[model samples]
Target chain A: MRARLLRFGPDALGKAGVVGSGRLYAAVAAGGFRRYATYRAATLAGVFTNTVFGVILAYTYIALWDERPHLGGYDQSQALTYVWLGQALLTTMCVMGTGFEEELIERIRTGDIAIDLYRPADLQLWWLAQDLGRALFQLLGRGLIPFVLGAWLFDLSLPASPLTWLAFLVAVALGVLVSYSFRFLVALAAFWLMDGAGITQMAWLAGVFCSGMVLPLNVFPGVLGEVVRALPWAALIQAPADVLMGEADLLGTFAFQAGWAVALLGAGRLLQVVATRRVVVQGG
Target chain B: MDSHSHSHSQVDGSFDESHDSFSNNSFNESFIELDGVEKVFDVRKKTGFMRSERREVRAVDSISFRVARGEMVGYIGPNGAGKSTTIKMLTGILTPSGGRLRVAGIDPSRERTRLARRIGVVFGQRTTLWWDLPLIDSYKLMHRMYRIPDARYRENLDRCVELLELADLLDVPVRQLSLGQRMRGDIAAALLHDPEVLYLDEPTIGLDVISKARVREFLRDLNAERGTTVLLTTHDLQDIEQLCSRVMVIDHGRLMYDGPLTGLHEVGDSERTLVVDLERELPPVEVPSARVVRVEGPRQWLAFPASESAAPLVARIAAEYPLVDLSVREPDIEAVIAKMLHSMRDTPKPPPEQAERSGRAAS
Candidate 1:
């Protein structure tokens, strides 16, 4: 990655901004990364909340399994790891979908979207880049801290094999893509809904329960676990956490995540085309 | 997104080179041409609880006009007059519902991104710069966003920074800067790619006297030096007075007047306000032509038709009352537009200029 970064160069990135240019999308992604870094207080707050939640969830799971030998596939220790990893992936999934609602809705309401659309870049890709950056930032700043704190606080078990760790990382990355695609679609709802707060909140609520962040898929009774795992929402939080805990098959989980990412992305692109065609900018 | 016109050729080297053979002749010709252009918005209003009525608002009625290269035209109108709708359609921000619109031989809506390479837009009501980043950061972002060549981007940034007096403020976050400073930053950001045409909407809306003067001067120099076509929408008549040679007056989605700024007085048939002071408090001054619109202690404001010579009214006032002091004020563009809008509502027929527009066909 370091060598490839040097090979790309700054001039290549500048030209990336032209319409239909992939480099432009990467540049925008990097820009989104830099933009999210500006909110230092928010980053710290997110880290704090996520870490605190990880501790609480780990303790709750440890207490839940005091009587049972094993609940689902996870032992008491594995259940604690699941809770910690789930907390780590919380921001990346953007269950509340980050600051996209306010940012997009404000632009739509103010008619400043005129300037946004006036640019040569594709609107969907532009936002995708921003979401990717935000996901990366949350992954690094908030994701890592909670995992480390949970590891220290809970004496958590680490993946024994390098292959397991690699698969876990890949699953987390896919999880981000799945999360971004879902959030991107929800954000587009702002164009149609006068105030998207209700829709956004509902999406967040659905993600929380369905994505296995509230309760692990394995905890759902036999047949219910299969249904939960089949849903794309589970790929965002459950699949990555399950892979990290070695509770799910690595290859199968990766394939399922990749499939969901591609599907959601295709849906987002379609929505973008439909939304752009009949743009009814308010308060012009 | 529509990629039909983008084609990569539009963003390569020289802007003119990318526009192809059609641009060469059209370059010096009518740079901005609109024939029978119109924008109708389907607005929904809440008639009652859980119900609404959909209404089609002809924001920009069938309008036609041609703007030559390097021409600075002022587009002025009262609230909801569709001045903004026209500007939006020109920039491809809003698609026109009817008629044909072209900017440098490119269909603005169909070739929006392609046209973006050659056009710049600034909405003074909002800042395009990144709110959390320094003023220069937004320019740096634009530097990549517009694919402005390195040398040209650097040179333009430096020139704008120097000319716009944005030197020390470069590091200040946009949210921290004053409205005038942010506006200058926005203007600089727009010009970084050296666009051939610029659309400025209320560029001096909330600016102070000194800042407004600076912005107006910068626009004047930009037009004179670079020959950039300017279409300005402003409520401040001074912006038109100082920068534009011609002005287009729009009202109720129709072109009420389209001609020279000097010609506006005749078209609007404006009025003049004469504040007269008598030696003592008086009921009102009796004048044959002028009527006292307001009266204060020892002072009275008389309204007289601007078309007629003010000399006769002054003579009549002086012959009747002992004048302490008197001064005449020309009818401001705001007042002229108000009168124009009122007179326009009184008649069902379109303005004389608009009557001839249906004769012109789309290119």
Candidate 2:
């Protein structure tokens, strides 16, 4: 697979006129990958931070799961896995860093979005491809170390089947698409509001709380559990984590993620078209 | 490349003839056409606590013009004069609020993506290159994004790299490149797809003299060699003087003047200020063709027709008055447009004396 990817050269990108060409998206994804790969120091700092947070959260979960055994239908082992999974997926889902949305907001505020509009590509898909590359990088660079550390130190539920790993990858990919779509909609508010920072903050808060970053949605008491589980944010970290831990039906969880990805991406595409129509490029 | 050796004098002559023909509405081969195109922006300003007022700012009022293929045109105006607004409308970034606009027979705003393949734009204030990636990485990405064929991509890349002097800087990240280097990199990125029409907004805004000259030379050659149409907006009059044979002036969202470069001076009634330092403080020195616009102590400022030779005015002053030292200041675009608008408000046509002065200046 690596050799095949490397073999795709300039000619493989093919003609420019065709829309939705796989090679075109692949190149954009590669560009995105290379763009983030330059920040080696930032990646190191993020890995350190994620590992530190995972250790802290794992100890806290041990204490809580000890007091209320099998709370929210999760055994002690499963709860530990959930805690570590949250730490691993934090940056992967962009629950912690507002990198993509902040960049989009800055582009809109400074009128640099005009340069983006000049390109012969769909705006939403272009950003989606870039975000996928970023998520892949973050998952490998930041997600793995914390996960490995957690599994080594704590009694965590581990999946051994290659087939199950494949399902987890598919679930995470859909989760990334849903995350990008949701953030994209919030960023598009910059066209009307002129500054998306406030909305971005609110979006981030909701993502952190409802996506089960702070605590698993399954632990929420009463009606809130059902409510949080239904939100699009749940599709980002909670659903993917459930798939990884084998705590939920594989097809059912995949269906939930795929459904939110399609709905949110469709809404994002619609908002993008409308927002670009009234884009007031701030500077001459 | 051999055709590039054709003297600019011939190009200027042809441009003047085309200018006359264009004004007569006789040219039918225009690639960019705008008929009474308009763009109005609604801005809401905060006045007091929880109070705001909305106002419609007509950024590009009903302005119309046509740019032919292979013609290099200069679009000049003061800040907030709607110059960028019009370019935005032309590039389909900002849809016009009213009227018909077409580029290469395609309605730009309606079919913006299709039009994008044919046109390239450089916004001097912003960069489209990926900030964290190497300069060559941006080009490689553009190579795929535009999907220029492998052979043609290499050929165009080689040409731009050779002409723009981008070989050494390709490995450096975009953020590490200086403004001039980044600008060149950007220009090269825009041309890699072989766009037929190129729009440059303030391409030489912050470039130093050598860099500016190099950029201008590259642009001239690009236009000459590829026959690519160019619409350049700039504050630097020298950019207009050296690069463009036909200049269009826009102010207050209106097309104020569209003609040969020399005719702009005539219409604007622009003047050169001659600063004369006398031996001592005295009454304002008088000359036949120049008038003292200001006098302080031993120094005096004389305003004369910009098109006229300052040699005769200097000689007359030196022989008749004590001239310690003198220097001439060329009229800038803002001052020229201000004077032109002032004259236009006062008279529908050029006053007879001003016309005669331009004639003498021409001779």
Candidate 3:
């Protein structure tokens, strides 16, 4: 078996090499950057919207606190930090939407998926690697730059320690894995379902609302917040922001995120196997 | 297995001994084998939101053939006749539902990766190379994929470029090239790994005549020099006539005919149309096994069984009637195929009257 695997190594690499050479990752990155660069104009508009919402929410929080020491284990500074982190991470995560789903559906429709099926490499792994490459570019070129600029201009609370910064980087990697696995699992619905785009949209919307994109999950009602905290969607965005803001327990957060990553990765693989079997049975 | 191999060798030895005493004949070996292979597709038709309709489409019915090394075999069929499906099964792109298949001694469906290393495939309608990248970069990527040695890579690349005339187009993005140019590049890309078997599906579908000829010539040379086994599927009969010595005709998911091109022409009662021009206007020339199809102004077109010797008929015409111009046109492949398909539609009918009579007399 080991010998066979070693011999198969070059075949897998060849499959990956064909996909990688297309410069698709670079094009996707460039496209994201161009869209976001033009979206800087929208950022100017978001500035006003953020200021209005922040001031109104801050006032409402202060009035509710009645000068109390802390609310929900967060001091006023930390509470404000949550707001800023939520806004910034929302922009970052939202930049990597399920755009590849349409392409996947089209490929499946046209029987182009046969090419990937014939390759020696694992199809899901190949696509995940490409998506990872695209995510890295978007995180750097589209997400990080604009995020830093927004925070700097607005005087948001930044990470206080290098350890916090390091933790944030780890969290970001886990977050991307979780997000990509979820999106890929959704896209694999094309094997069984006719219109996977609708499913993707619903999943994206659910993730956006439940993962604290519009508002911090802590701001939700007691049961709702607890439910959101338990779901994997929170680990995609909220957990990363928690690390960056030094609000999460380091080891516990890492363990939780790792657990979600492993579970989702396994689920994605299982779904891939089932979907592939279904496709084969369908004679595609 | 060892005993089987020994017996096989012994059979070969005996055959060689018998032939070696007479003529110096070189025999090409079989690289692929398909024994009573069958592939059935379960085509499902979803009706309303709740219920579903299901049916089976036997894309490839029970059929068997072998491809010899260094031989180019043309697989021709009409649309939906399962040519692509058969190619897919042979290349390990699709698994067969039943029977045995082997390529290079490996079951392609079982050891696809190993099989892929020995075979190259080009589906003409699709571009396997990266559309956004320059064609050269795609080739380099493929080189890495197939792990071609640097020296071999350079040698193959140079040879392919020279053969396909792709030097000028290598640096251009695949999206920028014309269809013909892109197909040439695609063919070159598929051959970069120096695979033993090349499966070409509609390789010249959209190519101009010049490009098509260039492709055919390149393929001919490749087969000659490398002894590569080629299984080409094309709608263009010209491609078959020019490249393949053997042809397999499939229709309605079954092998209707599998042999030399001559087998199609020798359907027992082959007919030829002869157009004759007479010096003077007219007399009805009565000849057995010949019918006048059309007559206009000193000219008469006659249809006759080609089995009726053309020499005597021509002599009789020359001796009996004054002729200004005469021409005989062989039946076109298109017409032959059309007739074959028409016969296929009328499946329950006996053989044609002429063929039946000839068979009865022989019996």
Interface RMSD of each: 6.0, 6.1, 6.1
Error of 3 at B310 (Å): 14
For model 3, name the residue pairs that clash: A14-B145
Per-residue CA lDDT of model 3 for A13-66, tens digit only, reads 676654543343344344334433444556566555655555565555556556
Per-residue CA lDDT of model 2 for B155-210, tens digit only, reads: 99999999999999999999999999999999999999999999999898899999
**Candidate order by lDDT, highest to lowest?**
2, 1, 3
Off by over 4 Å in 3: A1-96, A278-284, B1-28, B44-54, B268-335, B344-363
Best by lDDT: 2
Q: Which has the better DockQ: candidate 1, or candidate 3?
A: 1
Query: TM-score per candidate, in order?
Result: 0.85, 0.87, 0.75
lDDT of 3 by residue, B1-363 (tens): 232233234434433443432223222345676665777766668898987887666677665666777889988877767787788788775778998887877787667766776788887887776665678877876675566778998999999999899999998878889999999998988888899999998899889999999999999999999999999988776788789998877765666566666555544234778889999779666676678888888988888874455777778888878878899876655565665545544546433652343233222
Fnat of all models, as shown: 0.43, 0.68, 0.16
* Backbone clashes in model 2, listed as residue pairs: none
Question: What TM-score would chain B of candidate 2 score versus the native chain B?
Answer: 0.80
Q: Residue by residue across A1-284, what tens digits does model 2's lDDT show? A: 23222222233365643443566778788777777878999889988988888889888888998899998889999998988888888888898556588899889988899899888766787888899888898888888998998899998887899888888889889888889988888888898888987898898789889999988899898899999999988888888778878888988888888898899887877777678777755767
Candidate 2 contains a number of clashing pairs equal to: 0
